[model samples]
Target: MAKTSSSHYALKFHRTSTWTMFLVYVILLVSLPDSSQEDCHCQNGCTDFPGSPCPGTTCQPDWFGSYCQKRNIARGKSTSQSSELQGYGGPFPSDKAVDGSTDQTLQHGSCTHTGDTTSTGAWWRVDINTTLEIRRMRIYLRRQNTDRNMGLQVNVSDQLCYTLSADNRQQTVLNIDCGEALNGSSVKISVNGPYLTLCEVQIFQCSNGWFGDDCDKQCQCQNTTEVCDKETGNCRGGCAAGKHGPGCQQECNDGWFGSYCNKQCQCLTASEACNKETGHCSSGCAAGKQGPGCRQDCGQHHYGVNCSSTCGQCSGTSDCEKDDGTCTQGCQQGYSPPLCKMCAVHFYGPPCQGCGHCKDDSPCSVLNGTCLTGCKPGYEPPLCITACIPGRYGENCLHTCGHCQINGSCNAQTGRCERNCQPGYMGPLCIQECADYTYGINCSSVCSCLNQSEVCDKITGDCRTGHQSTTTAAAGASAAHQGQGYDDIRLIVVSCLLAISCVYAVITTATIYRIRRSMKILKAEQMQQYSTLQVRGESSVYDVIAERSVYANESIQRHGDQDPNKN
Candidate 1:
């Protein structure tokens, strides 16, 4: 019974506690601010607020501040005021305007208030620290005394951006479009009234290549490198290649091409257009022109289509015709007219120059102008155009000339002396020395030396003997006569001596003949006496007489006598 009673009391207590908690939750829900209303006031979504249970809100894109009313660009930037408000609720500075706050209450210290109430031009400024292309501005005016913001002028870098009239005096927020040209690093707000007060200043800049309200438009720039006008979207630099017009969306017209369509085509037909991108002609080039663009003229010595034809041999330093190969200035000296391709009668080579002097006045080789039959007298061989040099002559200029008078040259054909020969020299060439016993020019002078073997000087006719002959012509003749006389005398003497020798020989022969005859006679007589004695028988007497006769014969023979009486 006690446990059941305790359980029933605990159940009633639990019921009473649950009803009280439910009443407390309902009261809290009714007392709190509407979350949906708060969310509606916020631009983006809400976040937790500092020191409050309620959530805070964030700004939309390009917006800032607690209420999302200030531009993100001008928030927290450097600020200044022409003068600061002094005394009670005074000291309102310019920095309060760009503090990313939209609070309009002057006592909240979120607005700028100039102290000079008597002066008309009270101003506040902010330096964004960077040049920006601002298209619009949102000015938050002080709710109380809104007349102070009337006749206010907004300037960007000293250029007038907008002006607020008296009709805008009661407005808490003024939306002003400054247009695309209003770009600057600093923004200023000035009132023509006595004082100036601004709760906030918002600056809105469009994104790159976008402009106009909400920055929903894109730019139409011709050059990709250049930026277009923020509002008008016009290319400020120029149109791109093959494009024309302000927006750079049109194609090039006929006969025009390249950048801005400024270049004209150079095609073979005057009405034809060229390539828009490269300025090349589709058709062939005009006459005397070459290359893709047809702007280049033909090269030197070349003409006609594609410069295929070669020029002819023009006269002097002139060039040939560009349309044809004709020599407009005339052909060279010995070449034919018009094309100048053929050479004249006795001419040769490319220039058709005249030939050299050949033998017997004959023509030379047509190709090289060489003397085919050999060169004429006094000239060199081969070309045979030049005469022989000094001291040289003959067919090929091979033979050297002889020594001539006064060192003069000899005849080129015969090698003969031009003048008389030198002294001691004779002959046509003046190369022979004077003959024996002769000297001087032409060997006309005679030698006067005593000895015939002696020679004389050929140049001076001087004798070479030990002693010189001083005898004149007449003296020489006389000496010659005397020599002849002495030779005659010698010849006579020799003749006489020969005659005496012959006589002596004749006398000797006679004496010898007589002695022999006497001896023969004596012998004959001796034999006769012996015979007579022998016949008389007187031998002894005959012997004595014979002996006496022999002695007598010997003595007669020795005496050269033939007397038989002595015996």
Candidate 2:
């Protein structure tokens, strides 16, 4: 009886301990948080709940997260689906998925549902309007009928983000993390079957140039205006000023600056580069250029470094070129071209005039137009500007001209006569007297004087008094007769002498006649021979002289035949 009682007491105590452990396990299981409920808490402070009143704040537009700090980029965006279900929860549309509601009930009309069809590829989509780096996506589904969500896919711009498996389909809420973030303008949820459903969908991204899960990390972007990728921290719009590399962390190479390091420095020294931010050269501008950028050209009429050089004498009133200070319209008269700083050759004076004829065609003085080497022929003197006067010619007008037909007329340079010389003169200068029994203008007329040895008067061709001695003797004889008395013995003596002189003159005349006649006869015969030779074209100079002599003899015979005593 004592052994049985002890066994019964031990059995009762073990049964009591087992029941207490079962009760503890049941309590712990009941108190744990449900996986289907949202794990979010009011960040700013929510004032109300769907079924209960509370002192908490509602999230602002596009705001989400525990602290309401992150932005839901897909809220209230445009939405569409493959097909709408019209009856069961009537008018279930795609926009219901992004209406900022997380309600999963079909009767409340907040969830999206596609019509039942035989086609596979049932889908729902939302356009966020602009492209963004999506960090993650959160989706809410109906609590019951979760098996219909299996094989569902989340896509950003048609790129697969996540796919639901049979094991995780039972979960009412889904959190999809987009590794490295996805760049897209629209988001889509697709299923293999024709039926699809969603209560709410949220898309998230970091702020400009910020990335990471908490969006606390800053991006190293080259361009300040460009946004970096949310996951990779890379600038998609290229590097900023003076920077390069994929992440925009590298400094620009030498002599390069500005966006993507594409701009080159314009410093005065070619080896030096300009400031990276402002593109300013530390040194002065290059020649013919000015301004802070060293890109603008010098002002008109100014050139060289800093535009310090002035222009030269250019034509008109226009200014010179800005580069080399040259005259583009040509230089002033008598001035050299291009720079125009000096007088041209053969030119002179500030007013500038052409030079006179110089000796050996040499250049004249630039200041006074003076022929430094002396004047050329026909030109007079110190300035060599005047020509030699009439009748005066030769070098420096020193030599006189010849006695030309027109008095004082000759070439100024050579002193050559214009026409023939004066009467009683010969030769080019007309200074030589007539010679060779010739006395006339140009010494062309022959002199006919009785004395063979004496030439005629150079001016008049008059013979000497001795040439007419017979006339003078006759006059003397008449004078003596008048002075003497008429005596018989003198008259008788004069008569006898006169008679004798007459008879002797007649005899002498007859003798001369006979000789002349004989000479005429001989000359006539020679003339006949000359005529015959002329007819035969064989006449000579002697034949012509013989013919003339014959005619002269005939004339002398006719004269001789006349009586000398007769008048």
Candidate 3:
């Protein structure tokens, strides 16, 4: 039985030893450093700080400190608020306790108030100059105020962050954590108690785009960089050239221009680009422009790049536009657009004006305003659009026509007098007048029967008076009595002459008888005897005398017949 008992005891001891070894192994495995925590590595021994509450191996993202437990960000970025209360100590300023210091306490250096006021609605505030994200906040309560029971409230950015009841002499500190950080710029603390006091108030920075304890500043460093000077809140190594301002959060204004907008621009005129740094004109200042800043239009005679080249002489005082130096108003009289150098053909007047009366659809000389062809109709030439001047007509209005009765113009092309001539004037040119015996058009018609001194119609040849001239009447009578032939007129004239001669001879014989009677009886007898003697000797005296008289009478009759006007 003793041997069996010994065996049992030995078996039990072995089993117990095995159990103890297993327990030791489990403890060893749990106490050793975890190899899987490699990614939690920290530089500069960030996790070796004394009095730190952080774990030694792992760090949360965006958290870096002596113990890998603190976040580098901003806090209290906006205004803070507090309920009115008298501090227990002599004038303990609220700002003194929240000044990032823990040395002050309610009895001596902290913000404290002594009164029987209710704990509810009592508050204090701190102002963060700017908006920010707040990660956490720590409060150091007065050391001597353990007996006071109070409900504490903490708010961040006007939103409730924490609520707690004070423990009986168990804790004098309060720490509020905003799990994901609160978006705010201010911190507020409120408590309902017999006395309100604080030693120090501390706040941690957030993970968002902010830094500094007051959260009044922004992080402008490159997004690739993860570290900054936590105290000064400066971006490490400064910002890139394109950025400026405290955190390098601002970009340069867009004043740089040319090529890449990297080169500084120099311009003279307001809001214009220039070539020189001082804003003067230079080569390549701007395409197709002149003057400083490339702002002005090219001169009337200049064009192309920088207006360096001379343009064709434009007729008018117009110039090219600045953008491309194109003559939009059209080049000068003789020049064309763009360069304004090419010769341009144009009609007279503005663009809408017609070619006037110029013939053959011909163009005019744009430079001189001259017509290329003759005029049309009433219009004269060279420019040809105008009507002929008074008394002028033909191709160039060069031919002058006769003046009309009312001084009217003549035919434009034919040059005929347009209206009838004044009274006495007649014919196409009005050059002829009424003749003494002839009148009217072409002077072809004879004047009507009237006195020679009387006036007659120039056009109709009508006599003014009803009576005829004596000479004309006589001629008519003579014509009626005689035949149309000249020979008949001669015979009538001869008869009248012979009758007059016979009467004249009889008168002469009577005058001779009277003279002989008076001379006497004495001569009468002698005369008779002589006469009888002569007659007997030669054929009688009376017969000789009578023969001679007959011959004289015949000659006189012949002469009278020859004279056509004698009658």
- The candidate scoring highest on TM-score is 2
Question: How high is the CA lDDT of each candidate model?
Answer: 0.72, 0.74, 0.57
RMSD of each: 38.0, 28.1, 31.1
The C-alpha stretches of model 3 lying farther than 4 A from their native spots are 1-160, 163-199, 203-356, 377-386, 402-409, 421-439, 442-567
Model 3, span 379-478: residue lDDT tens: 7766776789887777788776664565756787776776675555566765557466555545654554556556567666567676466677457535
RMSD of 2: 28.1
lDDT of 1 by residue, 210-258 (tens): 4445543444455666766655556777666666665555678977766
TM-score of every model? 0.32, 0.36, 0.31
Name the better of 1 and 2 by TM-score. Answer: 2
lDDT of 2 by residue, 1-567 (tens): 889999999999999999999999999999887543232234444433222312343455665533343567778889999998889847998989989889988889999999868668899999988887675888999888888888999988978889888889899889889665677899999988888889999887665555556544446565666777666667877766767665565666766676677766656787777766445777766677777556667887787777898777789887777667778898888888787766789888766777887888788898888899888888887567789888787777888876666875677776766677667777766667788666778777655555545677776666673342455434543543454445656888999999998998899879978986787687787777666554433556655667677688678778768985696
Task: Tell me which of candidates 2 and 3 scores higher on TM-score.
Answer: 2
Superposition TM-score, candidate 3 onto the true structure = 0.31
Q: Say which prediction, candidate 1 or candidate 3, comes out ahead on lDDT.
A: 1
Q: Arrange candidates by lDDT, descending.
A: 2, 1, 3
